[model samples]
Target: MTPEAPPTTPTQAVEIVRSRYAQPKLPDGTPAELKVHEFDIGYLVFAVFPPRTDAAGRPQPSPPGGAKIVVSKETGETVTVPNYPTEKAIALYRKNVERNA
Candidate 1:
């Protein structure tokens, strides 16, 4: 198998951006929420996921491995919560957020 070429032009970059931002809605017709907002971490776009719930009706932390983005619907605030898959990545993301804020 051969590798694909990198994006070469501004148009290609825009297309790539659009594709990355595209997401499918859930079965209940609730669209995948992606809210852009101002935070302590400069500007960041948040992709809101279905809230993970417990049997006791509590909101649980998001699953591991996948990226976690936190947001407040009422306040319109957002933050890209670090996905601590690896120690290095976790530290790097945290540091970047801290430095930006």
Candidate 2:
């Protein structure tokens, strides 16, 4: 298959994230999925968590220490940032972009 071009839209950015990261897994080996936690025209942020209740039927909070994936809308580049506030993550992305530019 041919390589995908850099994402120019939000939907394309999402697809890139999904394809780039493998499915998330819980400590017990249960599989989880990445969900879009926040998005803007310039970046998309994804969080790793189980989509439904765990095997024991208890609600699962997202695991800590899972870095959030940020997809750049302008370049299709990706960066993993600490699982902190959304605003802070965006700021870090901007800083990285500037530093590289």
Candidate 3:
């Protein structure tokens, strides 16, 4: 076994990033922002989100302080995203995003 080729095209990289940033909700009605990529121990991808802070300068339930939704590119899974209340909710969310897009 040996190393595999990395994504060479900008379009491919962009698509990967986009898909990971906006993953569809799970079957159990859980929303996730994950990207699947080949793992490289020396390299990492960081998906940074704006901080969710209050007047008290404390972290809120939403996102985080300069939240970075760091995920394993090799595995499409994470825990920062919200869990949908139901399948209907997931469907509705996807539908709305698609329609708006």
The TM-score values for the models, in the order shown, are: 0.35, 0.64, 0.25
Order of the predicted models by TM-score, top scorer first? 2, 1, 3
For residue 90, what is the lDDT in candidate 2? Answer: 77
Better of 2 and 3 by TM-score: 2
Report residue 63 deviation for candidate 2 (angstroms).
4.3
Could you give candidate 2's per-residue lDDT for residues 1-101 as a string of tens digits?
A: 12356676656766787777776677578765455544553554564554556889988675458677777655577778887788887788778878978
lDDT of 1 by residue, 1-101 (tens): 11123333334333333354456366487667554433332223335678877999899987565453333222223334565333444455458656976
Task: Name the 10 consecutive residues with the lowest summed lDDT in model 3.
Answer: 36-45
Best by lDDT: 2
Number of the top-ranking candidate, with TM-score as the measure: 2
| lDDT (10s digit) by residue, model 3, range 1-101 | 11233344434443444555564454456654433222331112333234566889998775324222223233333213233333333444346535856
| Full-model lDDT for every candidate | 0.44, 0.66, 0.38
Spell out the clash pairs found in candidate 1.
Answer: none
